[model samples]
Target: MSLFFKNYKPNTSIYNRQVLWRCNSTTATQNTEDEEEFRVLDILKKRDRQQKRVVRRIEVQPDRTTKMKPDQNWGNVWPGPRSFHPASVPLPLRQGYVPKGQAPPGKYANAELMKIPNFLHLTPPVIKTQCEAIKKFCTEWPKLLNSEEAIEKHYPVEIITSDYCHGSPSIRNPLARIVTLRIKLSSLNLDQHARDKFLRIVGDRYNETTDLVTLTADRCPVRKQNLDYVNYLLTASYHEAWTYEDWETEKTEQDMEYYNWDNNASKRSLVDWYLKVNNDDRSLTEEEYKAFDISVIPHGVEYKDAVYSLMNDGESDATIKNYATAVRKLLGLPVKVDRDV
Candidate 1:
């Protein structure tokens, strides 16, 4: 080693640089090999941890409907209205809009079945059970009100409403909220003026033939509100009909709906003419004519009926003939005349 050292005449700068380079390369290579070994060990440790792990298993509960017997009382099971559930119902209900040829989808997870209202709660058995449960709360019908006429007479106002059931998402119907009230006009016990006013106020709502007045109110959103509104309308109209307006007293003969010989100018004219004929130039003055009673005359009743029938019923052949006959008889002429005059 001494002889080799002596023989090695070192190139000081170049030799030192080469030694430094080799040492750095060796240190880098060692560091790389250590990193690779740690990485491989970490991978093996992860694999070992995964293999040692245990997966948990959970027990599942079965559907309640699966245990239900076929003969079980359905009224008890479905007591009232509720949303549709697939697992709870046993029947194979199929529904859904699909292509024309393809069959309808099954009830399982079907949106169509869930969307619409169902009548499961209103089955015959359920209805009967419900009726029996509430039977004790209801009162017995009165024996006197046996017939429709009797019932109508006792209960004058009849309010009507409707309920609907259809294949719809919502059970509520717009038309069902509408209310109708019906009552006979005579039931109100109105006087002549009040009756005429009431008829006018009701207009087309009053049925002249049947003497029934119908009131309908549907502006409200609910049935109760509509019913109350209709009742209010009927009450208001009845009260208003009784209230006499100043303008109504001024209604003239031309404005009259029907002819009445008792209050008409024709009665005064007929009385004056009859008096003049009987007493020779002794005729009725305006004041005496106003106070005159047509019944004191012989042909007053016959003349009144004929004139009323003529004017009230229009100029028909029968009315004209009756009027002519009454006029001739009142003046002591033959009723059946040969000439046109």
Candidate 2:
């Protein structure tokens, strides 16, 4: 029985050792499979990295304006009106509401500077080019209008008007309807009667110092209408001045604004006094008057001019002394000499 039991135990132990060996072999196989799977995954990851495109970071260059040549045509760069662009202009422009003593912000990203209109497109070269392009459409200036006097003589009337442009929605300007017509009073061919009538008709529209007649017309709604209205007013005024009336003939010296020496009673009285003082007959023949040569009389023309000035222009101390001297000369009176007593 002892021998049988010992043999059974040995068989059992052998069975146990076989099971342990199997378990160990299975674990080793699992570890080897895991390591092969890890190697495959690593190969796939390396292949994916190799297939991807190479991404190299490239640095962009600075603005072209920074490298602009001095001799480049600026007009071609900026040909028309546009908002200011700091990157496009090579100028050292800066704008900002900075504190006192501090430098203004750089032009880059400056909202205040970009908000306003820029005249950089209207440089001297651009202006010259534009002028040359449009010059072909312009008419030659008239040779007759070379001098100021010639221009005034040819174009007696001057018409003035205004034009305006803005960014507002409405393009019409109220001031554009106003038309001013200016002319010189001396330019009108009128005699004394017509000139006096014109002065009376025009009233305060005439400037005494400049002798300019200005007529402003804004009653009409349009510029052309106002211009036409002013022209009609001017024509009517000129015709009215030329027209003669019966009452005008009866206008006396008191009614006249200026004195007329030729038509005055003083002239007739002076002639009569001179004839009486010289003991000459009023019925003398032209030959006899020629023989006397009355024009040679001292202070004849000067006395008339002085008297006319005294009556028309307000009398002064100088005029009074001139009148006394003329009277003394005309009357052939002797001058009183100052004697030492």
Candidate 3:
């Protein structure tokens, strides 16, 4: 080749093409041998046709409520608290949001109907059955407390509490913890001093119109604890009201919040005036004079009552005028208007 075509060393492009072709052929042969050696046997053999898996869906039976007879016992179907189920209940119930002018969604698949608790189990028949079952455990009412008066007399205290039930994660209610204790002020057997002290201690808790004293306790987290707290408060208040302190004895008439006619100077003066006017020499006690029935005397008991009204109740114009007329009559003084006439 150097002698014939000295300038043309085998063309680089042609030589590359021949070398590439040879490399490609060698690679192909090696790949063919490798593929033949590693070939999976019986791949060409027809495989048994794979059996297709057919899914079968069994039809669900109709709801039991649909086949229920009119005389069927509903209590047996719903025995306790549970979410409302449209299919289990025979009624034609429907519940769900509906656009204006359209009927509500049927209860068949109503989430709205099923989300809330229902009292379907508490039918009249079910209630009667429950009562019959529980009747054996209950005792007869006491004969002594048969009447309302007797019951109130024996059990003066009234306690109020509330119970709540709902479809919530927690059963506890804040209002359930509150306990109210109520009793009539008259039923406490408190004397004037004790009654005054009790009223003062309780402040606005006493309702003057109804004479009811109410105490509420809710500081504790539990209902029982609050109830106990109210009971303790009631006992403490009763005992404290009955206790007499030295400071109370030191309280003078002027220091008294309300007027007392029994110990007033007006009463003593009136008694002395009455005795002097009657010329009764015997020194008689207030109780003895009251027993003497001063109403028989001219303007005697009337004058005393008028004075009491002026003192015990604050002096109103009408009471003051009445007291003046009564005093004039008791003293044998002519009435000013009568004298003028």
For all predicted structures, in order, the TM-scores are: 0.62, 0.60, 0.73
Cα RMSD to the true fold for all candidates: 9.9, 17.8, 8.4
Winner on TM-score between 1 and 2 is: 1
Which of candidates 2 and 3 is the stronger one according to TM-score? 3
The candidates, ranked best first by TM-score, are: 3, 1, 2
Q: Candidate 2 residues 1-341, lDDT tens each?
A: 99988777456888999999999999999998988884336776678778668999999989879788999999888989888888789988988788899999888889878776678999998899999999999999998789999999999999999997544557788998999999999999998778877888888999989999999999888999999999999999999989978886788778877787766666666766778777976764434443443365567777887787687667798787777777777777864444899
Off by over 4 Å in 2: 1-64, 94-116, 162-167, 171-178, 218-222, 249-254, 270-280, 283-306, 317-341
Extract clashing residue pairs from model 1.
Answer: none
Arrange candidates by lDDT, descending.
1, 3, 2
Stretch of 10 with least lDDT, candidate 2: 285-294
Q: Assess candidate 1 and give its lDDT.
A: 0.84
Model 3 lDDT tens row, 17-65? 9999999999999998987896466743535454557999999999988
| Cα misplacement distance, residue 145 of candidate 3 (Å) | 2.2
Better of 1 and 3 by TM-score: 3
How far does residue 136 in candidate 1 sit from its true spot (Å)?
A: 1.5
* Model 3 regions lying over 4 Å from their true place: 1-49, 273-279, 282-341
